[model samples]
Target: MIKVEEAIAIIEANSTKMPVELISVHKALGYVLAEKVFSPINMPPFRQSAMDGYAFIHSIKHQYDVVGISQAGDHSNIKLKPNEAIRIFTGAFVPDAADTVVMQEHVMANKDSILIATMPPKLSNVRPKGEQIGKDEVVFEAGTLITPAAIGFLASLGITEIEVYKKPKVAVLVTGNELVKPGKNLKKGKIFESNSVMLEAALQTIGIKKTKVYRVKDNLKATKQALKSILKKFDIVLISGGISVGDYDFVKEALLQNNVKELFYKINQKPGKPMFFGSKNETLVFALPGNPASSLTNFYIYVSPAVKNKMGFSEIHKPKVVRKLNAAITNNTGKTLFLKARYDETNVTVLNGQSSAMLNTFAIANSLLIVPQDVEEYKKNQLVTLLPID
Candidate 1:
């Protein structure tokens, strides 16, 4: 067994970036850019009107002759002479020789001319050329995640396709004969399986869509055959259960037989001590503990970060902050304990059901309270590190 930090370090050293591919900007949301994206042309592209107003050369006179009108997406060829103004709407290109714009609300319109009710400042309500962005400027750097705002911004600059790291193909294998599907009749001692659904939803939340779930019975030969087939097909395989030293625990043996080099089998942590991580060539495998809460906790602490790193994210770890504890708690084990909790900006409350198998308290938890090894008790109001869940 090893400390949690050591296990995390081992994972970090092996998580490599995936290959890049060209994808449409429309489909690039939530994906990290593999290369820098530059603006093709100057944003706004020309001096534009910021409001529905009169475009004129700034002068001492409060009145001017109305020459023509300009609306959005229309280019004006009419040039404004001295004491002349153009009726320009928002987003319309400013006519040549016009340096100021007075909003329509501030001026009184006449048949052939408009009278300005108040003297407007020079270049008021006028957007200068390249005011938002210049041509060839780096709008998004490499490793930046493309969000909805990013999508709109890139589209405005005519970005049709972008280079992004491809997401990993994954297969989830849930092993245990005692596990029955949900909505079915419960047998003697069997329980409805929740780990597969929980793990699938967790993966989908992080933009990993290439996933499939399979269930294998608790036999060594069948488990080995299934493992051998899955190893040849997927880049990452997430197996839940059969990692401990029980008679039916065969995940470790199956992995070894298929040439998966064991990186670590157990970690010094509560709820997830039997978590297993290994690799075979480019394929990564995370054999999480059978308990629902333990599997989800391990996924957040280890698997999620690894997947994000492979997708070219610069910040792969979860958001951590120092927050005040609202209540007292104690850990009896020598290993570190991750307790589920509810938190606001300044404080966190450790919820009930800290057991490895219970998911009741986890459902409402928005953060994980970190209890370091060697610390047996924590008093209320004490500051501690917390990992926020998204």
Candidate 2:
């Protein structure tokens, strides 16, 4: 057994970053960049019109002879003498001979010429080349999370591929024979199994969609076989239940038989004190308690961060905030308590039902208030650490 901080430090030390691969930028959304990317070409490679109007040389006379027209994607370089205007639309390339554009709404058109109705200066409504980003400039740094806008930006630059960190392969194992699948008829001493689907959804929320779930009986042979097989294939393995010491508990013994190195067996904390963490080569394993609240709590506190860290994210932990308590509380259990709570901008209210077996309070709670092992009492309005789970 060890402290919570000690367990977290061990996990971080053992976390391995996934390898980088060059993939199509079209498929790179929700992935992290492994290398710094530079802009391949200047944005708006030519002088672009910023409005639907007329392009012309600025004249104090406020009138000009209408020349040939130019719309978007028209590349003909129409020569313009002094005071000659070209009918132009938004996003069209501005002719080099013209230096300014006037919005069509402000100008009156005659048969073959137009009178500028608005007093505008030179170079108005014209987007100069390279105004957004210059060629060979730093566009994104390593570890940037790719988003939809990023893909469009790269595509506009004519870049088809990008270097990004590969996503992790995960496997979830649920162990227990007494568990029953949901929607089945209720039987004697049987509970509906939910941790498998619950964990799968949680994994999806963190951008990890490649995962497999397995259910194992409470026997040593099946436990050993499952552990031995998944440890060879997956980057991260999460097991729910069958970790505590009981007559049928075989996970600890089976893990030893499979030669998985034990990094930490337990943590001196509330709800999830029986949680287990281990590793085999590059494969990391986490065995959480059977209770719903405890399992999800451990997942958010430990597994999620470790998985995101392996995906090349620097900030992996859940967001922590400090707020004053809405109600007074006292704790003298001499163990760290992860209490479910709801917090507004300035104050947090601790919810009822802190049992590890029930998730009634956790469902309505948006944050977890960590009561340090050393701190005993918190008067109303005193500051405390609040970790938002949503």
Candidate 3:
């Protein structure tokens, strides 16, 4: 058995980054960059007008002649003389001779002539060339996550595609013979299979989409064969059952038979004490307990970070905070206790139906109240740390 923090550290040290691929920026959101991106051209490549105004050479005179008009996406290079101005719209290229812009609201216009009611500072409302970023400058460094705003900035720089770290290929191997697929008639002592779908959905939330699912019998031969095939192809493999030392449990033996080095077999935690972690070559494997709630709990607290780190994410852990407990609680299991709870800004309330096999209370929970192994009792309004799941 091991501590939860120790298990997380082991997984982190064993994880490695995946290979890189060149993908279109349109599809690069949530992906980490593999190479630094430099601006191909100066953003706002020309001196531009920041608003719909009159571009003119600065003068003490309160009147000017409008020589030409410049709308957005057009360059009216009409040179302005003293007291001469051009009608310029937002994002339009400003004439070279103009040194200032007077907003239309401050100007009284008569035909092509205008009277300036106010004098703005020189170069006011005129954006300088390369004001945003200069050409050949670093726009984003390696390891930056491509967010939607980053996409817009890249589009402004004319970046159609970028090199990014590839998402790891994952496989979910559910090991049990009595598991039945949904919509099937349930026989005596048989249960519906749900861990595969739940685990897959959990992976999708972290931007891992290339996942495959498989089922293996509870026997040793079937488990070994399944492990061998998945271990050979996937970067990360999640096995859903048979990790404990029950009569039909065979995941541990199968992993050893396939030459997988065990990193840790169990954690001193309630809900998921039978968890197993191992490695075969460059691939990482996690065997979560078959119970529904325990499987999901182990995935969030342990497997999610490993997968995120493999895809090049630096900050991958769930958000943790201290909140006052709404009710008193006691931990008598002599191990760490994980409970589903609801939390606001400063308080958390534990929900009912916390059994490992149940998921009803989990559906409404936004956080997990974690009680450490040594702490036996907690009074109402006592501060406890919680990991948010929503």
Candidate 4:
């Protein structure tokens, strides 16, 4: 048994970063940037109006005649003189010699001449060339995760394509002969299969779009065959349920028999101590506990970050917040525990009845309370670390 941090270090050290690929900006969302993104052209490109108003020289204070109207995407260039103003709409290019924009509401206009109600500041309400972003400037550095805001920023800089790390292919396997699919009538001593679906959704949320699921029975031969067949197809494999010491638990033995070198097994943590990690060829395999909450917790704490690291992200841990516990928690003398809890702006309350098999308690939990292995009990108002699900 190893400490949590040591196990995490092992996982991190074993992960190989994926190679970079050039992808269209439209398809680059959630992928880590492989190269610095520089602006090809200035944002706004030219001096433009920030509002619908009159563009004129502020030196000509009182009144002006509308020389022409400029709408967005206007190609005809117009020069302005003193006491001359152009009726410009938002995003229209500012004409030459026009250094100020007086909003339409501030100007009293007739057919051609306009009266300025108040004095406008020089360069007011005008978006200057390269004001937001300059040409050839680095907009994003390598290792940035391309998000919606990043896409918009790149588009603003006239960048339509970017280089990013490719998403890794993951294979998920759920093992158990007594498990039945949802929507089927439950036979005696049978339960619905859920780990694959839940893990798939969780992976999708973390930006892994390509995933394959395999269901293997309790038999050793079936498990070995399934693992062998899928090992060559995916960059990583996740096996749920057969790593424990039960009579039907053959996942560990099968991996060893098939040349999968074990990295570590039996992390010193509750709910997921039976977790196993290994590598067969170049494919990484993680065997999580069969229990729903335990499996999900392990996925968030370990597997998700590993995948993100492979995808080239430097920061992988989910954001955490410090909160005061509303209820006292008791734990065994050893084995670090992650307890499901609901936390809001004020307090974090541990949900009642946190068995490994229960998913309902996990459903309402926004965060997990981290209890060190050696701690015996926690009192109310104790400040503990909360790992958020997001």
Candidate 5:
């Protein structure tokens, strides 16, 4: 067995990054950039009016002759002379000679001229060219996550395709003959298998769309055959159950029969002590414990980071913060325990139903309270480390 930190370090050292590919910017959400992206042209492209009013050269004169109107998308050569102004709407290109724009509410209309009720400062309502982004400027650097705002900014520059790291292809294998699909009649000795569906949803939330699922009986031959097929097809393989040293647990033997080199067998942690990690060539494998809560916990703490790293992300783990505990609790386990918790800005409530098999508490938890391996008891309002779950 190894400490949890050592296990994470091993995974960090062994994780592989995916190859970069050009994809449509519209479909690049949540992907990390492979190269720096620069703007081809100025964001505004021209000095534009910021308000619906008059465009004029800044001067002390309160009145001027109305020359012509300039609306958006009009390229008419409308230039302003001294004591002359043009009726311009918002977003209309300001004349080259115009230095200021006054709002319509501040100007009084006359027969052939307009009276300035109040004059604003020079360039008060003008949007300068390239105010947002200049031509050939670096807008986003490599490894930046593409977001909705990024899409809009890229579209403004007419960028249709962008280079980004591809999402990993994943495969999930559930090993247990006693497990049956949900919505089916429960037999006397069988329970509904839920780890596959749960893991699938979890992966989808992280932007991994290519996933394949396989079910194997508790026999070594069946497990070995499924592992072989999945290993060839996916970059990441997640096996739930049959990792412990029970009589029926054949996952360890099955992995060894294949080419998977075991990195670690167990970790010094509660709920998921029998977790396993290995790799065959470039593919990463995580064989989590059989319990529902335990498997899910391990996925968040371990597998998610490896996946994020493979997808070229700099930050792979969940965000951690220190918060005060809302209540006191006693932990007799001699291992590091992650308790399901709900937290606000300053405090966290350690929820009930923390058993390895229970998912009820996990459903309501937004955070995990980390209790160190050596500590046994905690008092109310004591500060503890918390890991926020996405």
Candidate 6:
């Protein structure tokens, strides 16, 4: 078995970013940027009004004649004289020679002339050209995760479309003959299939929107056929169960028979020691443990980062926090362990029953306590690393 960090490094070194494609700014949300986006023109593009007011030269303080009215989209250029002002609405272009704007609330307006009750300062309520962004400025760097705010920023720069990395296709295979679909009557030794649904949701949350879930029985022929068929369709394949050395486990045998290159079989970790990863014809596959908590933990630690890296994200790790332990805990000395934990501002407390198959403790866990392989016990108030869910 290899260390978790070594396994993570192996997975990351082999992963490559996907090809880039042009997508509409509206559709680019949650996608990773493929290229650096530079501003072709200034953000405002021209001097514009920032408020509904009168645009005039600050030198002419008290009295001014209303020369023209400027509304949004009025391209007619009107230059202002020393004693002249333009009745401009918000977002309208500011006329030349007009360096100040007195809001209508402060200016007493008549039919043709306005009285300036408050002398506005220069450039007040006026958006100068290129004030927000300049031409050729780097608006967004490559490998950025485009969010709604980013989309708005790009739109402000008149970018209707942008290049972004394509979302990776994922195939989730839940293997177990004893597993039945939800809402079905459970027989003597059958349980409802929950891993598929859980993993599918988890993948979607990380921006891998294209996913397909399949149910495979524990037969050699069926498993082999399914693997062969899916290998050609998906960029990443996730197999739940059939990885441990059980009598019905056939995934390892099928993978080896199909000439799949095994990268690593297992890692020195608790709750997910039977995890396996390999590649077949450029398609990556992960065989996670059957237990629900173990499968999810392994997915977050290994598979999720691989997918994120392939999608062109620079950072693939989740947010972690440092907290002091509230109680003492002990574990095996040789294997790293991720125990379900609940943490707040003051302390982080481990949940009871660190078994891989248990779900009750995982339900209320907001974080995971990462215990390295060399440590056997932790005393109270010991500082530890906590991987937060969000």
TM-score of each: 0.97, 0.95, 0.92, 0.97, 0.95, 0.94
| Higher-scoring candidate on TM-score, 3 or 6 | 6
lDDT of all predictions, in order shown? 0.92, 0.90, 0.92, 0.89, 0.91, 0.89
Q: Write model 5 residue lDDT over 244-339, tens digit each, in one string.
A: 999999999999999899999999998789998999998999998989999999988899889999888877876799998889978897888989
What lDDT, from 0 to 1, does candidate 4 have?
0.89
For 1-390, candidate 6 gives per-residue lDDT tens digits of 899999999899877788899999999988999999999999799899999999999974698899899999996488778899989999998887888899999988898999999887778998989998899999999999999999898988889999999988899988999999999999999998899888988898889776899888999899998988888898899999999999999998888887888999989999899988998766888999999999988988898899999899988998789999999878765899999999999799999977898878887898889999999998999999988873
Candidate achieving higher lDDT, 5 or 6? 5
Query: Cα RMSD (Å) between model 6 and the true structure?
Result: 1.9
Q: Write the per-residue lDDT of candidate 3 for residues 257-369, one digit (tens) a residue.
A: 99999999999998999999999888999999999999999998999999988888878897798999999999998898889999998899999999999999999999889
lDDT of 1 by residue, 1-390 (tens): 999999999998888888999999999988999999999999889999998999999999998999899999899999789899999999999987999999999999987999999877998999988899999999999999989999999999998999999888889999999999999999899999999999888998888865889899999999999999999988789999999999999999999999999999899999899988999998899999999999989999999999898889999997798999898888888889999999887888999898889999899998888898888999999999898875
Q: Which stretches of candidate 3 lie over 4 Å from their true place?
A: 58-62, 103-107, 116-123
Evaluation by TM-score, superior candidate among 3 and 4: 4
Clashing pairs in 2: none
Cα-lDDT of candidate 2: 0.90
Q: On TM-score, who's better, 2 or 3?
A: 2
Candidate 1 stretches with Cα past 4 Å from truth are none
TM-score of 6: 0.94
Stretches of model 5 off by over 4 angstroms after superposition = 110-112
